[model samples]
Target: MKKIILSASLAFILFTNLKADAQIKLSDIFKKVTEKQSTTSTTGTPSSLEIGQGIKEALQLGVSAGADRLSAKDGFLGNLAVKILMPPEAQKVEKTLRSIGLNSLCDNVIVSLNRAAEDAAKEAKPIFISAIKQMTLADASNILLGNNDAATSYFKRVTTAQLLQKFSPIVTNSLSKVNASKYYSDLTTQYNRLPLVKPVSTDLTGYVTQKAIDGLFIEVAKEELKIRGNINSRSTTLLQKVFGYADKKKG
Candidate 1:
């Protein structure tokens, strides 16, 4: 009778141990499933607002950087890639002036043109930021996946008309303030006076305005690339999350 009792006790304890182990295994499996679902919900896909906001944020940063760089002294002059040279229509005038002893005058005109551009660049910040504010959800998606300069191109394409309207007047004012008008007038006057040279009447304000816009786009592209490729350049959590999706997709 004692042997029978002992056997029964052993069987009960064994069954309890087995049941506990099975419960533990089931709990671990459930825990793993829950963890996976949480991760998927959090990191699966970026929403439309996230996409639009991220793009706007990136563009705003790019515009700020571009405007700040170009508006400062030496911004246009020092940046060879975006430097304002003599307009194509006025190239002959520059050549003729350089051929003569008017190199000093030509140099002066170049410096003043760049100065005017730099001065006008400050005004571009608000105009560009305003344009960025108007970006649609559709535009944001294309820009996010676009090439290195895609965002810049989008910016230039959409805002150019308005930019021209606003920037032209500012460039006109800047031309006089920076003495670019005077220098260009002097250059052309000297060039026309020389023998066997065609009369040149390039629109100095228009030329500088166009060149400054181009320079801004270039700078913005660079800023965009910096933020896209470099982790450190993404300063905000939104930036991190938005661009993190891009990185995963690219990979």
Candidate 2:
């Protein structure tokens, strides 16, 4: 009877302790969950705003470097990775011209296309900077935890339309400045005049605008890769702090 009584008391105490411990654990879990749901990541890492700032600085570097390189003479024409060429739709035109010994005209058209892209690239910095300023905390967090080109992809997705709108006039002016239209007109006029060949259109503004944007993004991606992969590219304390977290998370 004594043993039975002792066992009952022990069980009662155990039950009470278990209840208390469960309550404490539950409280701690709730606290942690609350903190997790907060708008920023501030535990042992930079805050979301700081991350956003770092990203902007990084993108600024990327955009500035890319735009500067591409704005230089032969920036696109010389760089095979991003050189603008005859559109696929116009491939037949190029072939026909080349076959007829109009290779110089084809060459001029290709050069002008690259030149227009280079001319429009110089104006991309301010637009990209403005877009970076509007990045949300969610965007910062996602980018912080994302792959090397993730930020670049996000910028492209958000800014492509605006960039198109902005790049149009610059490209248009560039085409005129470099006489790209005249060269294209010459190509099409010759091609259409040939018997048994389908008529080709002369306007290339839409194609140039799209291709130039694509080339710019390619350059931006290269800069992003450098920033993510190279310590030297993290040019500021904010970048160091934010990217440090990214490295840890990546590992």
Candidate 3:
């Protein structure tokens, strides 16, 4: 009887301890879940909408800045990096002209080319914004985590055709407005008449239009790099959050 009673008491003790232990474990789980919920509410990951919009906004700002800077007077002419120069085929023409004391003519052609580029750059902002608005969510996500110039590369890819079509007419008009077409024709005519020179028939409008587009992309790439690498370049909360997550992912 004593043994039986002792066994019952021990079982009761064990049951009580088991109940206490289960309660403690359950409490711990609840606390952990609550803490996790709090952390998530305070600092959650950015959603697809935020990521997509953030990338689009950044591109918009970058492209606008690029267009504005390049459209300014002396914008292309003053910047050695993006300065329009004589096409490769016409380098010899330029040299010959310069050697014959036609330096003024050569200078005029170069200045006019850059001037046309600057004039056409004024139309870039709206086209770029339109292209950016059409970007897919997948593209935005890829650009957010891709290389520093990924956004620039995507922009170039998607907008090049439209830009070419859009810039050609403007560049042609700008060339005329700036007297580039006349100067180029006069210069080429002079070069073509040189003894034993192959007839040069370069398309000045096409060359200038292509070069102007290239220069704009260079400026856009610079801005994209700045936004990706420098935290301060993220001008909005969404940009901060989206790129901040990218920073961590990269690290």
Candidate 4:
């Protein structure tokens, strides 16, 4: 009977220890889950206002930087990626002119074209700011979660028509100011005078306007991608918070 009682007490102690161990293990798991939830809740979601401001700030920064860079002297001329080349229809004109040793004229036209584009780029900042101001909360939210070029795509969709309208007059004025129009006319006249060669007529103002807008958009896209992917490019606390959430979502 003593042996039986002893066994029962030992079994009770063993059962108590097992239950305590299980409870401790379960508590550890629960603690970990709670900690994860707390961390996520605190850091994973940005407020709607923050979302809007963050997106706008990012776009503004990108467009402003792009506009500034392109507006500077040699911005377009120096950048092969954004350089405005002669229109496809005028390529023959340039080649023929260069081949015939009218290299200076060709160079003048090229330089003047880039100069016109650079002059027109100065107008992009206000226009971009206007478009950025028009962005809705929903738009900002979608852009925040969208692809790297999402903001640039948004800008293109909303601002292309306005940019074209705004840049046309500016480019036209700049073309005259910079002598691009005259050089182009001279180039075409020289090319057309060559025997057995077809005449080439191009809308110089229209071409420069479109190319300038394209170059600005390209620069903006690069800036957007940089900000989205490079944490070092986040130049503000708001950017860090907004993009930090985006980073976790991607992961």
Query: What TM-score do all the candidates reach, one by one?
Result: 0.79, 0.79, 0.81, 0.82
What clash count goes with each model? 0, 0, 0, 0
Best of the two (1, 3) by lDDT = 3
Residue pairs with colliding backbones in model 3 are none
Candidate lDDT (C-alpha), each = 0.86, 0.86, 0.91, 0.92
By how many angstroms RMSD does model 4 differ from the true structure? Answer: 11.7
Candidate 3 local accuracy as lDDT? 0.91
TM-score: which candidate is best? 4
Instruction: Quote model 1's TM-score.
Output: 0.79
lDDT of 3 by residue, 1-251 (tens): 99999999999999999999999999999999998876554244789988998899999999999999999999999989899999889999999999999999999999999999998999999989988989999999999999888998898888899999999999999999989989988999999999999878789999999999999999999999999989899877678888888888899
The number of clashing residue pairs in model 4 is 0
Query: What does candidate 1's lDDT look like per residue over 1-251, in tens digits?
Result: 99999999999999999999999999999999998876654354688899899889988988898899999999999999999999897888898879868898888889988988898888889988988899999888888777777788888888888878878988898888878898889888887887886788987778888998989888988998898899898877677777888888878
User: Cα RMSDs of all predictions?
Assistant: 8.4, 15.2, 11.9, 11.7
Candidate 2 clashes between residue pairs 3 or more apart in a chain or in different chains: none
Clashing residue pairs in candidate 1 (N, C-alpha, C atoms within 3 angstroms)? none
lDDT of 2 by residue, 22-134 (tens): 99999999999887755244335777778888877888888889888988999899999899889887898999889989999999999999999988888888888887788
Error of 1 at 149 (Å): 2.4
Model 3 lDDT, residue 121, Cα: 94
